[model samples]
Target: MSFNVALSGLNAAQKDLDVTSNNIANVNTTGFKESRAEFVDVYAASLLSSSKTKVGDGVLTAEVAQQFSQGSIKFTNNSLDLAITGNGFFATVPELNSLETSYTRAGQFKLNQDNFIVNSQGGHLLGFPVNADGTSASVSLSTAEPIRIPTASGAPQKSSEVDIRMNLPAGDSFISSAPGNFDPEDPLTFNHSTSVTIFDSLGDSHIMTYYFIKDDPSVNPNEWMLFASVDGKPIDLEDPAGGGTNPVGGNISGPLSTGGGLTGARLVFDSSGDFQSQIPTAANGGIITSDFSNHLPNGADTSQTIQIDFNLDPLGPNPNEPTQFASNFEVTSLQQDGLAVGRLTGIDIGTDGLVRATYSNGTSEPLSRIAMVNFANEQGLKQVGNTAWKESITSGEALAGEGGSGTFGTINSSALEQSNVNLTSELIDLISAQRNFQANSRALEVDNQLNQTILQIR
Candidate 1:
């Protein structure tokens, strides 16, 4: 009986040492929780035995429990790295579309070949789909899906409208040459010129330069001539060779006619340098249309018609719009409604677990919202490998929610949670367990010595 008791004591001490050693080994592990070994003393007595004199039997290993406390967050440079401040776990899946799920506190994640966010174990990070306004479409865990980032944005759209606000100089001199004899290459032909890049249907850029030439006041008072060209090609008002409409095809055969120096729109301003023309609501504010069709780089839409809007807002009143002031000729603002396909620039994770992806085209959209889960009994969770926990019979059902909501913790981007194991405490436990083993061994040796003495007496 003494031998059995000492053997049990030694086994209990060894178990304590093993638990302590494991804690020390994983001291630097991410999201690792420390464990403790518990024991209870056994007694040799039956139900009908004497109640006053009961002898102790041995020590028995009762249970090994885990400690689930908050770990310290270590900030990193990677934006995908995340850390939870309080209680909650990030739900992950083993494969891209796999429904078999796993929970993790380690937030070290990166993009895979298919632009899916995954962990070191290739587990896909699951998230709820979000609306365009950055709100979660559904918060249910069953509705969660793997987060994927698109390589590029939508298709390219051709430039159809241009909004420009400019201040034309009232004190500028008129062109020395007549409108019919004006040349785009010569400086004295046009008073001022401003150019902007516009996109075609195939995402090709075309330089659209607007030349503002001050006209002769003797011919037309408070008026200016606006000459426009695309890629240095003169937009003809009427065919110079023939008095018919200029057809848009292959290439121009001869010089374009400018209606005998009355080719472009006449900017008729009031005497006070204020605009008096009512800017209409049609395309290009009902002013002029530079309609043309030319072959694109990749056989895209060639029939491109761009309306140049002079008024800032087509619907609003033309109060202090583009004016012919006494100041220098300057383009205050110019904007177009065309965009080329954009590449993925970066991603951002908010405290609310919202993942927003930004593109190179100066546009951003919400991709998904990370789902956070919490169990009623964290210690009751079964220890799976790689610093992860699994749902066990002892652990209650997982309650899913977004980060920073209720009992769930908030997500800290660019950060990671370190192991909660205390090295110093583990070392102390190691020493205590070693002493217990030595004491048990000494008791066993004493028992053997007493047995030898009894045999010598017999």
Candidate 2:
């Protein structure tokens, strides 16, 4: 019995030493959690034995429990590296479509050949689907998919409307009074000119130039002629009310010209330099709509129409309306609703686990939301290799949630979670286990000597 007790003590001491050595060895490992070796005293006695005289047996190894605690953060330059500041684990899979999910805290992630985000062990990181507005569509783990970045260009959009706000010079001289005198090649034909780039249906760029010609003050007082040319070709504006000949030019022979010159829209202003109305009343609020179906580029949408809005509101006093102020010609704002095809530039991950992709066309789009999970009992998670764990019976079902919500922590991009093992404490434990092993060895030697002495006396 004494030999058995001494042997059990030796085994317990060796187990303690092994646990301490493992903790010390993984002190610098990323996302490593230290473990402790627990023990329980073994004793067996019959009912006939006296309780006061009963002797206890040796210690038995109960279990090796892992300590789930927060690790220190180590920042890096890679944007894909992630760290959780509180409770939560990043869910991953062995392959792109594999459903065998494993949870991990190690976030040394990089892009694979297919642009999917993966850890060092090639485990694909899972994420939830996101809406157009960067909101997560679902938080369930079953709906999570591997995060993949697109390498192609972003979607292109054609120009539909343009908003212009400017102050027309009130003191400018009338450059032309004769009809059909406006020519894009000659500067003297128009008073002022401005150009903006608009997109076609196929994401092709076309220059839309606006030429402002001050009409003869005596003939059309406080009025100006607005001529537009797309890609150097004249475009005609449809009258808001009905069909009517352009006041500046005689009639529209083809798309936007009469007698080889571009016809112009009449801009009428009040005495106080406030815009009153247009001659043709093309659209409500003096907005003009031009159809470029006759002059669009090859393989482009021929029915595309662009609305040129000068005033935001027609009935109310709008400060964004065009003015004939006595100041110099200055365009306060000029914007168009169009987007060109863009190449992928970079990616950004927010603290709330939202991933967004930026393009060279000055556009940003939400890609996905990283999936996070937490178990009811973190210590009960079965250890898989590579600092990952699998859900077991002891550990309750994985509860999926978005980062930075409820008890889950915010994800830190370009950072990693270091090991939580304390080196100093582990060293002290090593010394204690060594002493225990030595004492148990001495007791075993004593037990062997006593048995040998009893055999010799026999």
lDDT (Cα, tens digit) per residue for candidate 2, span 1-458: 88989999999999999999999989988888899999999988998998788888989999999998999999999999999999999999998779899999999999999999999999999999999999999999999999999998988889987888898999999764333566676777778888889998888888888888787788678887777778887776665434546644434222322455344577778778888776666535544546777678578887887777787455745798889989999988889989999999999999999999999889999999999999999989999889999999999999999999999999999999999998889999999999999999999999999999999994
User: What TM-score should be assigned to candidate 2?
Assistant: 0.92
Question: Whole-model Cα lDDT per candidate?
Answer: 0.78, 0.85
Q: Looking at model 2, which ten-residue stretch has the lowest summed lDDT?
A: 249-258
TM-score of 1: 0.82
Looking at model 2, the pairs that clash are 240-282
Q: Model 2: residues >4 Å from true position, as ranges? A: 177-179, 240-258, 282-286
How far does residue 75 in candidate 1 sit from its true spot (Å)? Answer: 3.3
Model 1 per-residue lDDT tens digits across residues 1-458: 78888989999999999999999999988878889998999987888998688768899989899888988899999999999999999989898768777888999999999989999999999999989899889988889998987787655678887777888898888765646566666667778888888888877778887777776777665776666777876663323323322222212122334333324555657777776552222433544443555434456676677777766443443753778889999888888877776677889999999999887766777889999989999888888788788778788887889999899999999999999997888898899999999999998898889889989994
